[model samples]
Target: MKRRKAIRNIVLFSLGTGIIYSCKDKYEAIKQLHLKHLIIDTKQLDILDDLSRLIVPLQNIPELADHTALPFIMNMVEHVFEEKDRQAFMKGYQSWDQEILSIKGRAFSAMKIEEKQQLLSEVNEESLKASQELYTVFNTVKEKSIQYLTTSEYYQRKVNYYQMAPGKFKGDVLLVDLKNKNDE
Candidate 1:
């Protein structure tokens, strides 16, 4: 009887582990397929990745690139954004490249780290001060990018929320009276 129970427990544990592994594999496959179908331009995608890295750089913990946040951002832009907003975002994205070229006389990716930082700072300032459609679009994309990154599964898992234990509810539990305890 003891041997039979041991065998049953081992088999159940093995089966549970296999199921968990298979589910993880399936999820990754589905995510890859979704990314493949995304319609964003490749260069634009690279720019987004660079910007995301700048916005949320790696420190003691893993960065946006480690969690594949760029693809997630692209997926959001493709599916979550309204048509008009998507067009505006695309226009703003293109203007970012053009603006960089006009200011630095080279591609943004080719600039030095200090130069990139200065340029991004200028862009942020301009976005706040200017009321042009381009600036509005830039601000929209920046806000969305930050929002998506902070709320993403990877970020959540790496940060505090994942570590918190859920509290249990007990409807019939007697409430402790502090005054009674003091009297006792």
Candidate 2:
């Protein structure tokens, strides 16, 4: 019995070390898995990169440019969206680029960082006046925000900043729906 327990402990320690090394830096692992796919048309992809980074500035964590989510997003959009919608996306992209270029005299990605932020602000204002049927600029911005926060290294670090929550729980109680709060 003593010999069996010693063997079991040795095996468990080996497995733990393997798991720890394997789990190291998920961001770096994902980046390696997705790097080759990142090489698409620079012109089309740059808009996404520039816009997403503007929405989630790089101060708190890694820059959006570091994670390559913008290229991944562009690939997904070009391949996955319906034909008509893809066409609209392309058109919307061109129109937005033109608008920003007129304001800053350069492509959105090439503009100074401050100018990019200012352009996004103006774009948001214009989106507010959009008619019901039109897809507002804010919708594009929102999608870009979703794309960045879900994939960027900054977001990943933020999410993993804390250790995992404890697993064991003592008890549970039924919860009440709060929808009737308005009636009160």
Candidate 3:
């Protein structure tokens, strides 16, 4: 009995170690893929930030840039977007930059605000008419930006929409007798 128990413990330990190493290997592989594919450069990040600000301009807020939305959008793009969607976004982004350069003979980052707006409008119209994938990318960025901004604590606080916990529970509200015709 002791020998059988010792053998069972050894087998369990070996299996557990094997499973742990396998999980570790998978984690490393995922990390490598993220590093190679999902990582964005500073310039690209700046471009995304500028594009987001253009898409969702803050009117009453004092902040010049989107503090919450941009980061959230970036995080979603990195972690939540599927492989095909990520590829589509990358392709669309590159094409957008090329279109801007071809049209204005300058980098998008260097363009004036009016020029940027005009370019964006033109591209938006073209994307809507020409390609569903391009349109999806554009709409995704805009929608995600709006979603993150609206859901942010800062925006909620600014709008005075934040409610305390256990919010507004009515325990003993009187119910009207809708079934009785005379009660009305």
Per-residue lDDT of 1-184 in model 2, one digit per residue for the tens?
9999997897686445321123335333333333321222335445655665666544345454454444345545556666665556556655666655664578666777787677667656664233321243335545755775666555554543322574754365333432242223
Write down the lDDT of every candidate, Cα atoms only.
0.57, 0.51, 0.61
Per candidate, the number of residue pairs that clash is: 0, 0, 0
lDDT of 3 by residue, 137-170 (tens): 5777788988887776676654534556736766
Query: Model 2 residue 174 lDDT?
Result: 36
By lDDT, the better pick of 1 and 3 is 3
Model 1 lDDT per residue over 1-184, tens place: 9999997897686445321123334235224535322334445555666776665553324554444345455566667877777666666666666666765687776788787777778777774233254564456556766676667666676543443564864466444653353345
Give per-model TM-scores: 0.55, 0.47, 0.58
What C-alpha lDDT does candidate 2 achieve relative to the native structure?
0.51
Task: Give residue 168's lDDT in candidate 2 (0 to 100).
Answer: 55
Query: Residue 115 deviation, candidate 2, in Å?
Result: 2.3
- Report the Cα lDDT for candidate 3: 0.61
Instruction: Name the candidate that leads on lDDT.
Output: 3
Which ranges in model 1 have alpha carbons more than 4 Å from their true place?
A: 1-39, 58-60, 63-65, 127-141, 153-159, 162-165, 168-184
* Winner of 1 and 2 under lDDT: 1
